[model samples]
Target: MSSSSVRGVSATPVESIIEPLRECMVSMGSGHGKETGDRRSPERTVLGRVASIMEVFNGGQQVLSLGDLSDRTGLPKSTLHRLADQLCQVGWLERDPGGYRVGMRLFELGSLAVEGHRLQETAFPYLQALAAKTGMSAQLGILDRTEVVYLERIVVGPVRLPTRRGGRQPAYCTALGKAMAAFDGEAMRAVVSSPMPRRTANTITESFALWTELDQIRKVGIALDRSEAYEELVCVAAPIRDSGRAIGAVSVTGPAGRMRWRMATEAVHSTAAAIWNASFRFGSAGARM
Candidate 1:
């Protein structure tokens, strides 16, 4: 008998046993097998690809070609094409003359996500009150990655401050961002220690000075952005805590000339207290740092 036949004595058919074993070997070599069971599915790959594509829009990039998407997502052209097609079909992405951009479906999903956040729900009433009282734009924002994403806003009349309901602003320069960062411990340090970008002449460009200022914000529970993000705009922010940990911030923003330091400070204190109480009563009551 040949050596292969002699080993297993499978004279019936060599192809049957050998082929199955070869497939099993290949599966095991590629990090798939019974040892890992069927628990590891391809779902994670699909989700990861979708996430990669979504991340390309995080900085508010509105459009991208296949090459741009590939470069941004670090995915191969072929893979990106397949994924993009699926995303477009599902309304997560859309193609226009400019190329692929996030679609209204994603906006709808995001709106739902923001609506679900306990902070948004609990803070709206207080935000409305602040907007009503101060006659300014009141916003509820949270730290998402390195920026502050405004989840909800109550605009008093037609006031504008270079921001929108779903807009994002640098955490180091915005009153809401600073308010959230001050209580975030190491996260706050990392933000201030990182290079501070200059948004305007009044923007804080010094890391050390910003850190010192943040320390004061933590102690006082209020942060002031005096035209740091935009010239002639001022925002007074106060931290909103869940349990004992700060989770988000509420801000009243308007013309800097109208919001004097002392008045802004008082507004921040009163609004923050009301929001904090609402958060405890209606929102994530037990969620701490």
Candidate 2:
């Protein structure tokens, strides 16, 4: 105030002291100079830590202890504990005797993901029709990191197969998995190059033999699972394509003894065609977006 008055300028008691401090605070808070006040944010690190923890359960590892989770996620135990508590409060993680696993919050998020996929939404009605027409369970699956994840399933009756909503199957054993693998070209090769884990006696464990089988599947546009994933179950699958690329598969599954080869093949072909048509429609519409 005294300096400004001497220079023949006006000054207010409040403005004289507050303006400089406010400017300093603004400069300190500014990060990129894009705003009046900015701060260097740590949001990216927080998001990365959360993503790392979430990804640890992506490949069917459902449950983990604090120590195991820390080891698997490469996050500090103290930090994980803090984050885990926050996640648990929000229903993203649930503590049980086994350990912390994905909770209903994850299920809700997965439901949203499935809904966002145009193919899943478009193919649902057709899948229902296939299930009704064949009186068998119909499933849609997509390849996800060396596994086949069941994206949608329509079951008409109770079946003993281990397949369930959000379930994962070894890509080499299940019909839906094999159908996707056979048509995926280099992706299929990558899967075969990895160690193939056997889930049943009938599963194709040899890489070379599986390779030969995939060639046959490609030629015929169909794949079969005769108790390959689970004993006493059989499945027939066909590819669902969009723009000439197989994006997923449709399958009819039942007990081996009850599944007639001719009927199952017809169901697979028809369902695959329906799904393909739906995917095409979805793609054409999505172009507008």
Question: Which candidate number maximizes lDDT?
Answer: 1
Model 1 per-residue lDDT tens digits across residues 90-204: 8878898878887666554443343325567677777887877777888888765457888888877655657776688889999999998888776687787777879989999
In model 2, residue pairs whose N, Cα or C atoms come closer than 3 Å (at least 3 residues apart or on different chains), thus clashing, are 29-38, 29-39, 30-38
What's each prediction's clash count? 0, 3
lDDT of 2 by residue, 1-289 (tens): 0011111113322223233333444454444333334434322255446656666665556688898887887778989999988879987788878779876655544432333255577778888988887778889887664678787899877775577877887788888878877776765787678787787888788999989999998888889998888888889999885444466788988877778788779888887887776655545112110
RMSD per candidate (Å) reads 20.0, 20.5
lDDT of 1 at 170: 85
Q: How many backbone clashes does candidate 2 have?
A: 3
* Minimal lDDT window, size 10, model 1: 1-10
